[model samples]
Target: MPPAATTNLGYTPPDGGWGWAVVLGAFISIGFSYAFPKSLTIYFKEIQEYFSISYSEIAWVSSVMLASMYAGGPVSSVLVNRYGSRPVVLVGGVMVSAAMVLASFGTTIMHLYLCIGVIGGLGLAFNLQPALTIIGTYFHVKRPLANGLAMTGSPVVLSTLAPLNQFLFDSFGWRGSFLLLGSIVLNCCVAGALMRPVRKTVQLKPNTEPQEIVETAIVDSRGQLSNVQTDKRKTESQAWLHKFVDVSLFRHRGFLIYLVGNVVMFFGFFAPVVFLAPYAKHQGFDEYSAAYLLSIFALVDMFIRPATGFIGNTKWIRPRIQYFFSFAVAYSGVCHLLCPLAPGYVGLVVYAVFFGLAFGMVSALLFEVLMDLVGAHRFSSAVGLVTIIECGPVLLGPPLSGALVDIFGDYKYMYYACGVFMLVPGIFFFIMHYYNYKKLDEEQRQSLAVEMKTSEEAEQLKTSSDDETDGRTH
Candidate 1:
């Protein structure tokens, strides 16, 4: 818990101080957490050849890694709840590094699956949730920009790791590459070291008598609850669930809208990234040039994420950021739909640039919007719940896209299918949020009117009472 400076004290997020350091920490941990799986796909070809495995089987390595990461959200949240983000992130760095080292000595596919897929994935889960959870503690007013900067880690890391993985594989082969990659990710421990615990202080406003106050016991890492609740009838089951994550967000309308839309959107989200290189290869580009498309995408994505955050933070957009997020998703869908029209490497480069822009917009604003709906206090639980539910689509999206390619015997059809998948959810969010916003506005106005009416009635009663007392005294 944070201490007080003066009696007028409240632990307001010193939104800029050491918080920036925490953001940097989040950047590194989150970067490796997200980018590692995608960049590591560079070794899939060699690993396939060595293991003599088929395409589908090799693909499971990444799919399982992602699924495990997503599925472990609750577990990560539980650990973060019991401990703190610093210790959790530190332990996660060690766990992921160990998983990689263990994977290096694997003789069988199952060994890699156990070591990298489950263990490494859970390790990433630990890194990812803690990083995200810590950001809310340290910022409120500048949260959009803060989240924007933090999410930029994905593109920066992807671009760096793509080429690095290629060079590593060329120099040292798959086994050695995995071993070295383990050492490379120990940098997450350095990030963890920067996660200084936040101490919360409650600001008490003087009143005629003692009054109920709301406060968060721990403000830095996992802000589970802040509001003082008088209702103590919570069941044991609900209390147990709340110990790790708030299950009450399921009843929240805005969270429901965000969750359903995201579940739909993700069906098409990752598939394009997965198939981009293969699509380029199918279009007659060599392997290096084909792989370079990701670098192009990441480069553009890197700049756009921070830019999008800046845009979302502006007065005009920040109030209604959901619409902005919806537009970004729609833009990515349109990019995919038009990708088939690109003829060659130059055209593909243009497609990559636009796709990266749209992807960055969505990624930067994704959790920001969720936090907007549920607020920082419940964000810890909301995230875990959302990811656990999203695991199916995230895991299956790329494979489904691959199946589409197999069915059509052309990559263009897969692109078209993914475009539809994205566009529909984009439209869904736009429509649903439009009504949701209107409903919220109406409710706010009604509540204001009720408060005013009650105040006016109270004033009238006091005035009459004074008049009666004066008449009796006369």
Candidate 2:
């Protein structure tokens, strides 16, 4: 058991200090975690040509990578919980670097799947969960801002690596590019090194008199509760896999709402981006110009995330961040719905700007809102659960959208489908969250009433005992 301290009521965090440094580390880690897969597209054309594979088959490389990243989330979470964030993130960095280097030697698509998809994806999963978890440990008052800064890594890395990958591919071919990229990815190890464990001093409140106060002990990692404490221990323990991530999150009301909404939302989320360049190319734009569209989108997305985080950190917005996220999701859907109406390149540019904004807003707040709902104690498990469940949509969204194009030979219908898919979840989340807030308020009120009643009853008993002692003395 850990040593106890006096608990203080109504404590507010100072919100800034070394926490900002931690956010910087998170920025690098999260940037690579999100951007690596998307940036690899610079090699896709070359890969397809070299292997003489179809576009759909080549796309599976990224699809498998993304699916494995999400699928491996629980394993990463369990490791983070057991060993702390530093070691897990460092190990993950090594894994990603090694995967890239090994992929340089791949002779078949299957080899790429094994090295780049499975190994690299798992490395990213390790980076992602620990980075997000550590931010919660370091900052509460400025958490939104910190989260915003960290999440900006996605767009920043995408914008930087896309062109860099192009340069590498131009200079050395795919194999050489992979070798160099492996070295570049090793910077994640430097980021991981900066993620030192936070040491916190927790204070407990003292009793008024000399009565024994039974404190129920709970151990936390950083500031978050360890997963073992959250789960009920059995006399004879179950297997490690079942114990790793708490599957019971499926039954949690808030988690269920979040899960259902996200599952639906993801179907539309990535598909637009996947087809954005291809869609532009289909409309007679040159390859370079088409690729520039993604760079434009990513640059805009990079700027928007930090700006949204600042807004979310504001007094007016921070408390109600879930609503903001829901609005963003709905807004994205609206953008997709409007994409089919754009007649030319200029119109596509306009759509890209709005799309960038909506996407940035959603991505910035996605995990922030989850942490808000579940609290830090359950964040690791919650993230694990969310990612594992969302794997299907993440893997399927693009292919399914591609099929729409195959059917109609136009990208507009696919955009429309994605728009509706995104919009419905936004609406569902808005309604469900409103209800959830109401239920939560009611529960809080009831709990307060019960606490007050219990306190009053104890006071009465003490007064009666004092009176009886006085009577006996008289």
Candidate 3:
């Protein structure tokens, strides 16, 4: 019936119990993964002085860290698929902790780059994808809520760490702060510990798991090919790559649309946040007032994520969560485009409120919608592949937005550019996903028709054979 619904590992998810604990673990891992990079900026000014480097050079530390994390997605996905989330996240905890501890003793900017940027970033990458991927494995029905709750970790951690880093820097200095941070990050290992494998406790269901998309690569069609051994080796290598990467997802229409939309969406995604404080100062607001805008945005964002998740999981919205996600992106774009028109600090606060809601809504639904499109079974590969491609935008988007400011000598154009970046993709998602849903319905109906015809033909064949047997007996 219905061409075999794909379930996770032939068992319905527990959807509660240990899954909630796993969400807690994911919350820690994801919180650190996203927050640590932004929070690290607090050390940049002092570190710039310590290393005798330019502001631009100091900035590369954050850039390298973010880039490495995104680039590490494929490797992280492979490990999670092979060994499960617990080991990978635990190792990630150790690696990042080690990175911070080592950075505390570094003698040069290069060492900080290596330890904090590359090593620490990859460790965060390890923490991020596995944590996000595991939630999909453990809950299908409540996944949006789980994801929403898990995503709240980013803003919550960022809000906490921003102020904590300031205090740490004042008390312990950068080196001592790094040392304390190393210890603080040990919580991720505890989080990983909570992520005990789910399958051991889950009750086994019926034996009709859907076929895996990852399969052996097709052999060359010609039997008499001149280099048969070489062809065989090539095929085997392709098969191995397929096992880890799910290259077949390239052919999945919904996955393709989601991936491409994300790529375009991210280019504008974080730019506004980066410039929010600066934009306020440019408009004649005091520095403290400008900083308060970020606090407002983060505060609103923290609440909206869980709310968005709960809404996404509802019966009516769940089927159309993709639309909700698209609208969020478009709404964020509109908020930025209209920012220049705001009257004063009051107007800016209003913009912050709406932008935070839009941003939180998109972040909460991002992975949930991906899993919805590809099924929980294939989400590891789907997310891994998407993040790796998304690295380029996430890394460069802010710099490009800054360039608009450098050229225009005003912030509004940068906001305008970011808005356009988001709006176009939002529209694309709306149109393409609409068509994808339509095609899916048509395909389902055709499949049912074929099933019914085959059933009728089988019944007729059985009846005719029984009549012939009866006549022969007479």
Best by lDDT: 3
By lDDT, is 2 or 3 better? 3
Give each model's whole-structure lDDT: 0.87, 0.86, 0.90
State candidate 2's TM-score: 0.90
Q: Which regions of candidate 3 deviate over 4 angstroms?
A: 1-9, 200-236
What is the TM-score of each predicted model, taking all chains together?
0.88, 0.90, 0.92
Angstrom error of the Cα, residue 387, model 3: value is 0.9
Model 1, runs deviating above 4 Å: 1-11, 201-236, 453-474
Query: Candidate 1, after superposition: displacement of residue 402 in Å?
Result: 0.7
Q: Clashes in each model (backbone N, CA, C under 3 Å)?
A: 4, 7, 0
> Which residue pairs clash within candidate 3?
none
Residue 24, model 1, lDDT: 98
lDDT by residue for model 1 over 208-302, one digit each (tens)? 33244888454443323422232334466579778878878888999999999999899999999878988999988899898788888888889
Q: What are the per-residue Cα lDDT tens digits for candidate 2 across 160-241?
A: 8978998998999999999999999988888888888776746455764335589976665654464554454542354454
- Candidate 2 overall Cα lDDT vs. reference? 0.86
lDDT of 1 at 101: 98
lDDT tens readout by residue for model 3, 200-315? 45455565332447775656676545467688899999999988888899999999999898998899999999899999999999999999999999999999999999988888
Measured over all alpha carbons after superposition, the RMSD of each candidate to the real structure, in angstroms, is 7.4, 6.8, 4.2
